[model samples]
Target chain A: MVGIVGYGAYIPRYRIKVDQIAGVWGADVQSYRKGLLVEEKSVPAPDQDTITMAVEASKRAIKRAGIDPREIGAVYVGSESHPYAVKPSGTVLAEAIGACPEVHTADLEFACKAGTEGMYLAMSLVKAGEIKYGLAVGADTSQGAPGDPLEYTTAAGAAAFIFGHDKILAEVVETYSYTTDTPDFWRREYQYYPRHGGRFTGDPAYFKHIIGAGRGIMAKAAIKPEDIKYVIFHQPNGKFPLRVGELLGFKKEQIEPGLLVTYLGNTYSGSSPLGLTATFDIAKPGDLILIVSFGSGAGSDAFLFRMTERIEEVKDLAPKTRETLEGPKVYVDYGTYAKFRKKIRKANE
Target chain B: MPTPARYWREIPQRYRLEAGRCRRCGFIAFPPRLICPGCRSREFEIIKLAEEGRVISYTIIRVPPHQFVDQAPYAVGIVELDDGVKLMGQIVDCPFEELRTGLRVRIEFRKIMEEGEAGIIYYGYKFVPA
Candidate 1:
């Protein structure tokens, strides 16, 4: 009964292509295209960031939920690139959505999985009757070091979910998390960009935790891979989600709908959650979905959900995820991208 | 650095597009006013301005203020919302050449200004192609 009452997603319209980036660093473009399976990635405008994207996505969610923003009793925003290190992103998010003054709010950080961490907390709080409605958002204006591999996919976007006991769209059936002391990726305090363990970030980090959490949630829900109509795994790149889906016994077709990294790139905390929103855009009632998110520290959070009839009513109330992904996009060259991302240091600085 | 109090005080209008509708004359005020200009009535109702609108006038800001130097060559426009409330805001995500009267747009939340590297980030509405 306690589940998603509404959901929404936001992706910045500006994009920087792989060739544009690869040309600057003299890296092979085909490798990034055929290897990583990422053609281009979204770029946030100078005015867009984690907080702004979260507020936009949350507004869409409030519309889909058809509930007064005042009804939201709690708000949680998960992101790695919060604008201010000291200020809480949730306060800004809650206030923009008109959920301020009476809502519990906080900002969460756990790499890419941070968004689902917020989702889990909000759902739990709603199920426990601690609040009438809870808002969970996963958003990021993720950063990549210049010339680093991460630059190909570190992108900007956000997804928001409202959890409540009534008018449930996706009923939460089971939740599970697999975490460890793995340190495959990290950013030190005062560091602008993150450092990763390279090949070590694989096998030992993303794959291990995702598979562990995926199987654990399926077992807890007493369902088989075939029983689920769709599955969304945290997509750091276009290749990982497909490879991991095959390893987890899911068909490519079942995973393809949520495989958004091909166009939108990796939105960090927004990855799996955005995938879920995209799936909801087309999923039929009674369809079962399994979502698993991976974070760099590292860990995975998995949840089993069943679509309800109400999904048909609210799915069309706001902009669909694919519309933004495939809609009008402004492609920027490397120089313009550098300027927009603040990669160039000014003489004044 | 500008006072954070000025930014904080505008949150309701800047963050939420809150407006005041004169209860007496039915006039909508962008930043809710204490007294209605139409009828001089103090009674007003809080309402949200419509998010979708059309461009009534526009200009390109090639030379900009210090806060927007990096974002120069941008477009600013006066949009008349569907609710008949007119307001001015920056028009984004559209090419300058394409901007014209009666172009459709919608309000989106965006960063308006940031004070240096370590100051308050001001957020508000900007117009984007609908």
Candidate 2:
């Protein structure tokens, strides 16, 4: 089965709490904390970006896979915050993980669901016997306009999966995608921050696509929600995944482990994939996992995975997603956040 | 200095930490020289360097370079890897007052500099207190 051989995730250590952002705007901190269900959000350091985070997570994925990087033939990175507008982050990530000199690399952008698009491609390449191994990464140093509500939840992080036919950690049972020409959120060319249609990002965008892909994949796999032991959805906020999970017939217990938006916030492209990584860390052999991702351009990708015995052997090979989230975090104030994000014009400018 | 071609050529060393080791005398070079400084070895083996190292020396730059004016008063240091190769880089995620000789550190990939507004971003290794 062409499935996940190994997986890894990275969440930056710097975090900014809701109160900090709320204080800057003189908004109601209690309402944002209660409404978003996000206490704090991960923030990338001044030196960290999409490429660097992708490399770090990819390295861990390679280690867990225990496959020679040279043997991998393809690498794909999905992100909205690629450091360079034109450069492919896949090349940098592949080189960093020692998969270079012979690799097909591409950078994908489909908003938050782009990472799963990379995963889908890798699965196809591996199952077709066209490549011995392939690596797919979803990562983003997500952007938020100053004083925007998005600033409270948009965060920085990455997740990577190595796909191969042998020693499978989770077998790919089925996959599906649901898409439309709905414009929920977008950032124009040369725009530093994104703009959203507020409430319009809700009904016709995130929910419709997510539910369509989830039900479609489940139907294709010939399984119901009760058959799956775990479920993870693209978490734009802590509330959305929980609400979506319930709407899709999943219990709260099934969504608990993968519900990381409470701690890490929305990692944009990394959202669902990072949730998947966290689930893989805690899932057992023979467990079934259902993952559905929603992107801002109004698309969703869903996959059904069945865990294999090999998962127990390699789950501990890399740092756990929870451990990274629980590691020592440096909290930044609004002034420091402005400096780190370069929101304030410098003397040179 | 931060041109696209120069950045492209340096990626293997800067991103992957790939170095050339002299097959003759076991000497390692960071920039991957053609001839080994030790034993004048003609043959070399490509190797990846260990991520962890020690801060051999450091300097706090208050009067910064043109591109680094915003991030001034930062600390830069020379680190000696376990393989005995020394490389110079910025010391980050640590307090300036805390930086000193013999501090244990680990290398991390980071943005080193940028040319100007809307310019190419240069990425390389930086040392963080382990």
Note the residue pairs that clash in candidate 1: none
lDDT of 2 at A179: 93
Task: Go through the candidates in order and give each one's DockQ.
Answer: 0.94, 0.68
TM-score of each: 0.99, 0.96
Residue A213 C-alpha lDDT in model 2:
94
Please give, for residues A1-349, the per-residue lDDT of candidate 1 as tens digits. 8999999999999999999999999999999999899999999999999999999999999989999999999999999999999999999999998988999998999999999999999999999999999999999999999999999999999999999999899999899999998999999999999999999998999999999999999889889999999999999988889988999999999999988998999999999999999999999999999999999999999989999999999999999999989999999998988888999998974
Q: Point to the candidate with the largest lDDT.
A: 1
* Model 1 error, position A202 (Å): 0.7
Model 2 interface RMSD, in angstroms?
1.2
Q: What is the TM-score of chain B in candidate 2?
A: 0.93
**lDDT tens per residue, model 2, A45-163:** 88899998998898889889999999999999999988888878887788778888899999999989889999999999999999999999999988899999999999999999989
